[model samples]
Target: MNQLKGVVSHHEREIAELRADRELAVAYLKAAMESLDDPDERAAGLLALRTVAEAHGGLGAVAAEAGISRESLYRSLSPKGNPTLKTLLAVLKTMGMRLSVEPEHQAHA
Candidate 1:
């Protein structure tokens, strides 16, 4: 009984760590989306989205959550994928996130 209890406790700790890591991934993806402004943003966002999707299970799982076809999610979030606003929003929403716009910094005269 003591050994069983120890095993359960270890598993619980592992699960908690996984949850924290997943939350970090989600936060990083949100930050990446907010930082988009140049070609780099697209690249970074795609990578971040892919990482989050993989963590949640993969393209198929993410597609299901986003209410899109698996193939569509794969194509859109690929490194070369140019996702539409609708697709982007859907994926973010499925990940418990939303997009926000902030004012750009003023350029020097």
Candidate 2:
């Protein structure tokens, strides 16, 4: 494991940064949410929420507060995850956030 020494993982660093600043976490999540509409980038969006969940509270805590089992939370937030709208709303509500809709900037062709 010598090679693993002094290596801070992306997840760890991301969580730490999010936990340290609420505003940053909000911006981070907002940006991640934008990617949700793109199938090619959706995984990144889910993973981003997972990171914030890991930051705002431990997964277990967030899951419990969101009225879901920890295992469900983990599975739903996985890269290939497909969380239901109910679950997404629940998770966001638990984390003091919510979803909003806005018109895309691209003009209709």
CA shift at 70, candidate 1, in angstroms? 0.8
TM-scores, in order shown?
A: 0.68, 0.90
lDDT by residue (1-109, candidate 2, tens digit) is 4687789998789899999998999999999999999999999999999999999888899999999999999999999999999899999998899999888879778
Evaluated at residue 48, the lDDT of candidate 2 is 93
lDDT for position 73 in model 2: 93
* Global CA lDDT computed for model 1: 0.72
Residue by residue across 8-52, what tens digits does model 1's lDDT show?
554345434444686676666767676456776677778667667
Which candidate leads the pack in lDDT? 2
Q: Quick one: best TM-score, which candidate?
A: 2
